[model samples]
Target chain A: MSNLERIAKLSGFSKATVSRVLNHSPHVSQETRATILQIMKELDYVPNRNAISLSTGQTLQIGMITSSINEIMLPFLNGFVEVAEQHGFQTIIYTTNDDTSKERQAFEDLRQKRVDALVIISCVTSAKEVESYCKYGPIVSWQRMDNPAIGSVAMDQFKGYTLALDHLIPKGHTRIANALGRTYSINTRSRQQAYEQAMQKYNLPVLRQFYYPSTYTILDGERVMRAMLQQSEALPSAILCSNDHVAAGVLCEARRQHLRVPGDLAIVGFDDTELSHTLGITTIRNPIAAQAQNAFHLLSGPLRGIDMPQAELCFELIERTTT
Target chain B: MSNLERIAKLSGFSKATVSRVLNHSPHVSQETRATILQIMKELDYVPNRNAISLSTGQTLQIGMITSSINEIMLPFLNGFVEVAEQHGFQTIIYTTNDDTSKERQAFEDLRQKRVDALVIISCVTSAKEVESYCKYGPIVSWQRMDNPAIGSVAMDQFKGYTLALDHLIPKGHTRIANALGRTYSINTRSRQQAYEQAMQKYNLPVLRQFYYPSTYTILDGERVMRAMLQQSEALPSAILCSNDHVAAGVLCEARRQHLRVPGDLAIVGFDDTELSHTLGITTIRNPIAAQAQNAFHLLSGPLRGIDMPQAELCFELIERTTT
Candidate 1:
């Protein structure tokens, strides 16, 4: 016999009564509930929670899609998860490694399982394509992309990069180089736009040789710096890195070559992570916590067809010793 | 009329035929199915996937429990998620931050959603406590802990540390001090055992002054080294750090103080992560991909009641410029 049937037979109750007791229904009488609970323990029967949830018609689950779990992604996720938990909902994170098809597959899978909403982080999928998935549930993007169908909690990368350039320009530095890591990333593009705009405003020469590709972590930063040192005739007086990890690398390489930071080469980085603080590198503070909390609010929603708000978060320029 | 009823009326069929078409049943004729599909699109009705999944009785999903997503945890998760995706299962990771009650809540929540299994990484919960939860579904640990009910894919930290010591011992180093990151971590405890055991065997003093607490990231490593430099009467000839991040800091700090690696202070680290390679720090290779693949296999199984074999992964010491 199945567990429910056995419980029903032993408790001298119908399947529904036994199920109600198992579900902790207040409708069940005290004596019978006590007897049923005893029988459950004695039989070593753990009730089928899956069946109960399906019958109740509430999953209380939200789905998140991320490109990768790294220093950059994980902190935002932690903030997302924290807010999700506070709302009495559990988050299910799906990684796609920036593959559009894999991201679509994850979306289909989560939809099939009936997640309340989807939080997509830095996906390359078009707004029109994402709108189709909006029918499944509410979709929120981590990066701010203006889509009628999607809500986004975005940090102003343009303003952030502009602030970094402003910091270096005041320090009496010209011939500044910008290393916007990952040529294809939207973030890289946005930061690059700001860099070009800022340099053009000041009439500072933008050197193509100094622009490094695929730089993310400390290792990537070190590799880029090493390559620049080898390839370039003369290194720029100051370098604007995409993130703190790259800035840390530039600082390390400077240490190796007996060059003083801000004296020999001024460097300003994005994302004021712990590494940036340790190395005393000047960087922009990414509003990770704010983005996550706001995204959660937009996601755990009245499921679709509301005027989605555009939340453009402010960025801060944290100056210490690097610049 | 409801979506199914509207489709049936428009397609000149009964509600049962439209329901069959919706479910993709083989019994439905192709002509009728095509007709019903056309009507479904015309109606612009998004079917409730929850009802469909309930009727089908299968949800190809798994759950992973993690304390935190950091440098150590993120790589392991990437490996786990990679294998799960290959097996046509999507992973929903729950971050507990090492809180037992939070971990318990996540277990209950995932079980309710009927995840295929649970993969826990370095949880503080006891074997017996976790084994009890195994009645709901198969529970596998990411860290190797010997328990009949729980299957684990654990790296031999004792063996890993021993290998590091053996390498340094052969290099003619007697005054070898150790730095165990996280004073109370199980991995720290296990690695400490090997460190002490090796020192005892070699008739070397186990100095308390050399040991530092909570040294994980590069910043933490730098702080510990600085503290040692300030507090210690005489620095040890060699230092065995917990991980590569810590080792990198020691190397950076060594440069700061004009002390060369291996020449002034030889350093050995654990986890042959990419940062270790960049700095050329001699460290132990953590079999991240291997461990993740094995853990997933253990979790996504024909549930309980079979002899779950223990998967003890081996460790390797990578020699580099640091030591």
Candidate 2:
């Protein structure tokens, strides 16, 4: 006989009562529940997950959607896995490649597969598309989201940029340049706003040619630096980059051009990545691990009725050899 | 009634016949199958994965075990996801952190969950532990494994080291030093063998003091370089590093000490990571993507019953300004 049947027989109770005890339903009496639990332990009985899921109408699986499983997103994913495992839920990962159609398909597929919840990292979907899914189950965004239907766990990008700019402006950098990432990215927009405000506050000249729109890559940083170096006009005393990966590229290109860092030009970058430690690059340290942890908490904890949790992680400005 | 019931009623057939048709079972007749398929499309009936899994006793999931999900391992994981998705299988990642206990626990858990197969990116367990796990299911190792129980897919590390040394030795460097990774790493052993053989072939004196065993990090590389620079003895004309990240640090430290590349000291690194591309460092290019793809294929395909696929990916010597 199965463990459920044995528990029913030993306790002289119905299978439904045994199931109630196993599921911790409040309807069962405390005395009888304790007696049934004792019998279950004596028989070395283990509950069957298939039956439990069938009764509760829930699947014990969570979904994680990432733009791409590359270097830029590995640290976030590492934290996600660790937290998900502790919550006794297996994660089903879907890589959408930042394509809208693919993201929709992935969401539809995961929903069809009956995942209990979703944790989206860098969602590329529109507000309406995300809202339609929010009605179905718990959904948490690892990065900032435009839709209120999704709960977000992200760092304050505007603050991070302000810290970087504040560090540079106070260091006697009257003419400063900025290397911005893609305009479509929400984080980039926040950083761009901070750069603009900080420049205006410091009363520094903002050159149109100095502000470059590039992708979040070292090669893009190199291209922007090369463009700056080739200009016939006066060069900026310092440069502020979107992230450390791009900053590393700028440093490499500058060295290649036989320019001494902090001697020829001071530089600041966001995201104190491992490269920053090796290169001694001054940068803003975004709390990525903390953001990931908070995202996991929002995904795994009890669902709130209406208001979603919006937590902003702290940022730090690290001074190093670059600036 | 479910959508399957509607399709069966419309086709005037039993539910089993409809399910067989939907599952693409060989027992169905061609005419009836075609009619039922057309009816399914007309009715918009989708097969339930739970029912399919129950009928076929297949999970439709593959397990992946890796050392860590850092920048170095991101490309491999990306390639694995791309290939695994094509075969209609989801890849579940488990990180071992290069610990034997964690590796064993992950293997046992995956086995209990009944994953279709396993693909290990690096060795986290001893040969005996891996061999024991191989008894239950198909296990493929992306990194080289000496045991016959697991299939291996790895880049040609020995040849890569030889290529780097060949480029350097021909440049008239007699007193060459080596910056190796952790002594316990298999790749380190292979590269060290190649370096030793190359020095012997050229009849150059190999000094024990010239070799440094450090972890695979830029800071570790810098520390090793600083230690070497402080030594009273004469330094080697060139230094060969285990990986590009390490080589970048070596370059930074050399620059800090007022040394010149290809003038004061020539440098070469391995793996040709993104840092290598941005910095234009001379190194060996390993086929990381191809190796990942092959490992996924071995895990998801029919290679479980046969001996493991022991194939070596090709490597190339990329000449850059660093050398």
Candidate 3:
């Protein structure tokens, strides 16, 4: 009897179940999967990887390195996977939790696994940093670092930020604040530049006291709100949050303080996420699907050698009750 | 010059940078990585995988298949990855989106990749169906079905559902509704059965009309709430939502209709998510970290090669202002 028959005889499962176990089919109960796995371990049967790449080479697997799997990045991931797979490429995700070393490791790991390409989403890894390995295969990133080696498909970061400022400044609110996450992030820098320029244009004093840096979560927003309130500087009439979650936090905090949004303090949020609609917050919608599609076309292009363009998609400001 | 030196010279980067590019280090900038990659491609330098897998076999990589990367599952994933890496097992994730065929494909793919083991998370694959494949390698699942072949470390799912029902019925909620997600899912079935059993024990009729099957999102909760209110059947006093997101929807919808929570309609959510705390909706806390810890221990455990227990971790009912 083959390995399947031998395992079935010992485990009392049917031959088909043993076969299903070998094939990694879900049709087999978890119990059966375990029992068969135990038996396989006992038998010391290690299925190797050398042949699978050869067999499934046509699937054209692309490995995506993500910092963290969260709602904000899901659309980008979903779009990339959906579009890539539609064109016969499968996606394998490696979560590095934003660790530079782990990301570097993933770069090596994917290469060792013989993946056709690498599409990085939401990572701080610079193009120059990974330049050493980029020559081996196609690399695409959702971040824009002005890296020519990597095909870039990012939201028009600077323009997107100004759109928010443009909407807020004209409202006659000179006392404007912003929640800036990760002082080093390109997006944060872009938004910072826009905030300064817009405030300069409007001749509004830069209320640095109202600027909330390193805030990401709702609690951060709440804490920032509390901190800004305690500041020696005069209170700002408006606050621009980094994202909807933080905006929600500010709203909740404002509610706690009995301060009405727009009435007492106008607020704006980035990433018009699902919660933005339900929470009724003014936000900027990052064009995820378009960016993902553009990146996929460049990374998966048939040229195998082609000129990669800086594909910056559009963004829109959604005005809601908060502002 | 060797391939590395040749590429590095052409790209105007040091040999170390070229080696880093080939090695997939993050130290190289994206621009430099891209330039070197372009040079390598021009030189027809395709680094093969067979040798690298041979070199990196000591890394002890384990492949995990996830159904979907949503909020409820992230804790489990985080715990599992943290624990597995602690034990020196590197994880490679393959997302199948809960599609059975794709799950089976993951098994074969992982095996072909030559991973030491496979962990299946949140997939609805029955054990009996995939029994044959389990004989090939060690297979673990995050779900608890008690299939002899697979090792399951899951939340005490059935007991978890009853914990919610037990909390509600005693509060004198006879006219209770439930938001059931995926009628065929094991968790839904467990909750459905528990709902019936609890209602029967309370001597209350099973209000099937109040059961909103196939519900998942907050919008689904809103829709369910709308449907139930429109029904000629007497409106239920409270609703046990499938998850916190749905419960949030119900809460929002109730607010829309000017109905006070726990006054006109009591709401209880499962999977005490971050939103649960923010919204102050009472929810059951699924011990994801504990379950993940158990699953990791079992999957990473030296086969004791013996029988692995179906580790059922506990759940807690968190009561708040909503109830």
Best by TM-score: 3
Ranked by lDDT from best down, the candidates are 2, 1, 3
> Could you say which candidate leads in DockQ?
2
| Candidate 1: clashing pairs of residues | B144-B154
Tens digit of per-residue lDDT, candidate 3, span A109-166: 5556546788888576776877666766778788766677877776657788898888
lDDT scores of the candidates, listed in order = 0.75, 0.76, 0.74
- Report the C-alpha lDDT of model 1 over A182-259, residue by residue, as the tens digit: 577677788888878877888988777778867778777777777767864787889989788888877777767778
True contacts kept of each: 0.46, 0.44, 0.13
Per-model DockQ against the true two-chain complex: 0.28, 0.30, 0.12
* Candidate 1 TM-score to native: 0.77
- B174-246 in candidate 2: lDDT tens per residue? 8888888657767778988888898899998786688888657787678778878877888888888878888
Those runs of model 1 whose alpha carbons end farther than 4 Å from true positions after fitting are A1-57, A109-113, A182-185, A230-233, A250-265, A300-313, B1-58, B109-113, B170-176, B181-186, B229-233, B249-264, B299-313
- What i-RMS does every model get? 4.8, 4.2, 6.3
Chain B TM-score against the true chain B, each candidate: 0.79, 0.82, 0.77
Of 1 and 3, the candidate ranking higher by DockQ: 1
